[model samples]
Target: MKNLYFLALLIGFNLSAQELPNLNLLNLEGKSVSLKNDFMEKDKIYVFSFWATWCGPCINELEEMNELQEEWKKEINIEIIAVSIDDSRTQKRVKPLVKGKEWNYNVLLDTNQDFKRAMSIVNPPYTIVVKNGKIVHIQNGYVPGNEKDLYEKIKTL
Candidate 1:
């Protein structure tokens, strides 16, 4: 029982220590925004989702997020901001692709990779849930039913 308690404490500490780095990225219109400022506040939780145009899983995850965004927002004051990791050369494709998909979430461009490196994210379809400027959850590789889990996390915040 004592070992079990120690193990649980270690897990809790590790979870709380995992943090998302501060990053500044540009929006589709070329305006700069700080991830720390834009996504977090004293009273709000932000969902920062990183994706790329070339990744099929990323596209599917964003589509799933869009479908559930409204309902999620109504229940919890959560906002999902989609960040595209496509480089500047391929940046032109982002707007049209997002538009074509009819995604209603806020979209930004991370063409310079500042955000990706800050979050230590090497793969597309990564998500970090931030609350009060601290990371609460970090997930890589999206699965079809993962949004339910995400929603539950957001609801708890």
Candidate 2:
């Protein structure tokens, strides 16, 4: 019975393994990048945080995640990526804001909304946690205390 259950679990995981699109985005220095190839690492828990400059919840979530950077790295092999979905209007402020806050994680540009659309994200403050090249968890909206839940999920990985 145990062997049958384990075999079923393996088959389920194999069938549900779908990767994000190999789309090109930009880094803070304005260089084109591939999200899967460049940012992702093998056997790591990486968080893709979709945010914008003007969003209050988004800012709060990112700042909270930034605070957890050092500890998360020390404990688990995790990386948090801040992907901005700001358009041309507010895109210029992204750099100054990030520099001002002194965020510790890598920032990526999705001004054209290409990456966001590809991922089917419809809102800000959404998070995707990937482990071993597979997306294990995703949160659509964030509340003030959502970081704790995210941490717990990563711990389970």
Candidate 3:
């Protein structure tokens, strides 16, 4: 039974890789946004990093990505959309936190966590490198130097 479940999960992930899941996550302004359907660009690669206000490691990873924002845009047409998986209890804190951090990102809210489960995201700091309507790479967690590696992977794809 465990093996069967694993197999099904694998197939689900494969399908997710081939096509972006249609999810109705809300932006910081409470407007519904779909990463693929609403924000598609001609050749832009999107990095969707799932995080929460309380996740320390998640904040670290996002900060690292923030530092490289200029270089990434200068080199490639890319956008990093930070998706907050904070529930309703803490959702109200998102705006102030973002402002305090000065993270110039299209901060989206996954207040219900629907997108996370639908995309099979297990935890915070999970990143999906997407391009041309498909997932190019996925990074589950991060270390201090992982941002450099992320940039290199984006360069190849």
Best by TM-score: 3
Two-way TM-score contest, 1 vs 2, winner: 2
Candidate 1 on 1-157: residue-level lDDT in tens?
9999999999868766766566777776778887766676676778889998899999999999999998887887788899999997878899999889999978888888887887779898999888877778888899899889988877777
Q: In model 2, what are the clashing residue pairs, if there are any?
A: none
lDDT per residue (tens digit) for residues 105-125 in model 2 = 789989999978877889898
Q: Model 1 off-target regions past 4 Å?
A: 1-15, 18-20
Error of 1 at 4 (Å): 15
Model 3 segments more than 4 A misplaced: 1-16
TM-score each candidate: 0.85, 0.87, 0.88
lDDT of 1: 0.84
Q: Could you list the CA RMSD of all candidates, in the order they appear?
A: 3.0, 4.8, 3.4
- Whole-model Cα lDDT per candidate? 0.84, 0.86, 0.87
What lDDT is obtained when candidate 2 is compared to the true structure? 0.86
Residue-level lDDT of model 3, residues 1-157, one tens digit each, is 9999999999868865776778878887878888668767767889999999999999999888898999899998899999999999989888999999899999999888987887789888899888888887888987899889999999887
Candidate 3 global lDDT:
0.87
State how far residue 55 of model 2 sits from its true place (Å): 0.7
lDDT of 2 at 140: 82
